[model samples]
Target: MTQAFDIIIVGAGMVGAALATGLGQQGIRVGLIDKAVPADFDAHASPDIRVSALSAGSERYLQSLGAWPALVAMRATPYRRLAVWDETPHPLSRLLPGSLTEVEFNAAQLGADHLGHIVENSVTQNALWQTAQAQPDVTLMTGQGLTSLEQSPDCARVTLEDGTELSAQLIVGADGAMSQVRTLAGIGVTRDQYQQQAMVISVRYLGPPEDITWQGFFPSGPRAFLPLHGAGDQHPDETWGSLVWYDSPARLAELKALSDAQLMAEIGKSFPDRLPHLTHIDAKASFPIARQHAKHYFLNRVVLAGDAAHTINPLAGQGVNLGFQDAQCLQGLLKEARRSGDDLANPRWLGQYEQQRRPANRRMMLAMDLFYHLFSNQIPPVHLARNLGLGAARALPFARNRVARYAMGLDEQLPGPVQQILHRLPGLNRI
Candidate 1:
């Protein structure tokens, strides 16, 4: 039997599930397919090692999809302050004050209640899954993997591993960076792997949950801190936090081999002094970082969103936020398409989506890559230049706030100066 839908979205992760929910709310028949279901939330379990910093704009989008309340009910930590500073030591560093070397954004100063929320990836996925499932127009095909994809002049179709066939006016590839749907749809990506790999550690600290998150940049890479929820009665007076240590593969491998106690000691010595006293190591994992962008956002009846479209450095915690932006953009376009009584795969709307999103995604990728390259370089001139840049940002409040607002998705355009910098960056035409 053939299952028909207005659209079939592959990969029911954050972006796909949210899209399904949004489209369903508009009365669009959607098939949300994924091989694995999000794990049920458990209050007593340790925090998921994989987490994302959801920006305020992303919060509003999720709230519109009816997932934010469920996420808060499960667990979400809002950070009112975000700080980034240069930690690399140099003989010239003694000349500058600590305040000049660091730039912090406060919610109060920005006229916002909180900057963003640090959420476990599982909790977010589960919340979106629940919201998606509640949509009467959405059919969630979980535990079924996509095996094949086919497209005709009229529509696109996909086959599951169990031989169940589904057809829709459009097939969306939201499966992620290594997207099978992307491959099946014949889209290619340009990928550049970074020298440093990020190792994330989930641990409990001896303090209440924190309202701030910070990252210290080094020659190797940036080490970051994201505060999670508090520990339960089993460990009274403790809170959970996530730490990211980015370094060479060999160095992270050595740290990964250490016992819990040994790793904790090493973390104390290596991470910024501001890290709270960690009480227990719950889980740890590491993966290589890369900048990837799809050559095209759509091909014929198949379209891409989220990680399927692009992936950027995780330094700023903007990956999932970008994905959410993609979902929101595509959802709006699809709604417009339905209103016009056009095929959901109409290139007119899909082209507009790519046109609006590509530059935005590319700009973010370049910005992150700029930070990655600038901070990772050890050349004295580069180091001094970056420090001066940070100092200038702190010294100039208006420009600093403008950049911050752009990053927070509160502003649509990157400031003129920043846009010019991105434009002049080498190899700008390629990415």
Candidate 2:
């Protein structure tokens, strides 16, 4: 069977689903596909226990697309405080080297109600899926994979593993880091693998579900603890919260083999003093990490979005946030093109999408790599310099604000308040 739509999305994950929701809202007919959906593993209910620190800018894009309310309505956690320090430094200081001295970001200085929210990957994707269900123009096909893609100057033909074919002005590869559609589009990736692996654990904390999110940088990587909302007031018994501890793959393997009681004890010891203590009710899983970038964000009638286009080190938890930016940029650009009577499949428009996103995403990938390398070293001098840099940035309110703006994805993402906030930062003048 051969069919066509205005747009066809090859991946149904967070990014793919998000673009589908956004385009569907604009009355664009979209065909969204995913190789498979989560099989409902309570143990791995959330793929890769880590949650994304969605920047306020990305949040606004999702909100405009009508995905924010559903995300919030589900089980997302709002973060007001962001604390960071060197791993060797004890969390007990409650202070950077000086008062409030810490790494390059602060929520209060950013002038937003909060930095952003920590959302379970599953919850975010699920909400987007639900939203897609309500849109009449969006068609979803799951449990099928992309097999072949052929493109011409005017249009593209996409064939599925099931021998079904789709022709569209544009075919999007939102499949993921190992995207089949990307390969079908003949796009290659520049890649790197971080030596560290993250152990993501969801636990029950003794205290009320707090609103702060914090991380401690260690020689291996960084350990982040994010507060997720509780089950509800009515269900009083169900506990809430999640923590992600980044360590060497060898170290994580040893830890994962430990019994539950032993694992909780290790969790207590591994985190910095600033993070709250949480009892580990669930078994922990490990994620061996890496970095991936699409050689091209678009080609002919083919384009990439989300993990299908770029996969960042989750060190700062920016993967999905970047993907959201891709979705928004693609949607905004195409929406305008359609309105102006321009060809949606025009290579010029597709080239602009690549030009705008490629440089920005590449910069982010480099930043993550730099941090991962510089901090993952045990060299005393580098450690001391990193600590002082964090402390120094904290002291410079202007610098701190700039760092905050960047972290929130506001500076690089949207136009309104986030952009306004970023413009005031003198520190960002050079970048």
Error of 1 at 277 (Å): 0.4
lDDT tens string, model 2, 1-431? 78988899988888999899888988888999888865432432433365677778778877887778887876677788776555544443344444223454446776768878888787788778888868999999888887788887777888888899988889988888888888887888877776677888877676677777777677667888778766445435544677787877788889888888988788778777666656545646777677777777887788999888887778777788888888888998888878877878777778888888887776666555444433344544333334435333333333333443444464653323323333342222322
lDDT tens readout by residue for model 1, 16-84: 999999999999999999999557888988888999999888999999999999999999999999887
State model 1's lDDT: 0.85
How far in Å is the alpha carbon of 239 misplaced in model 2? 3.6
Superposed Cα RMSD, model 1: 2.5
lDDT (Cα) of model 2: 0.71
- Per-model TM-score, in order, reads 0.94, 0.83
Residue 314 of model 2 has an lDDT of: 81
TM-score of 2: 0.83
Clashing pairs in 2: 91-273, 91-274
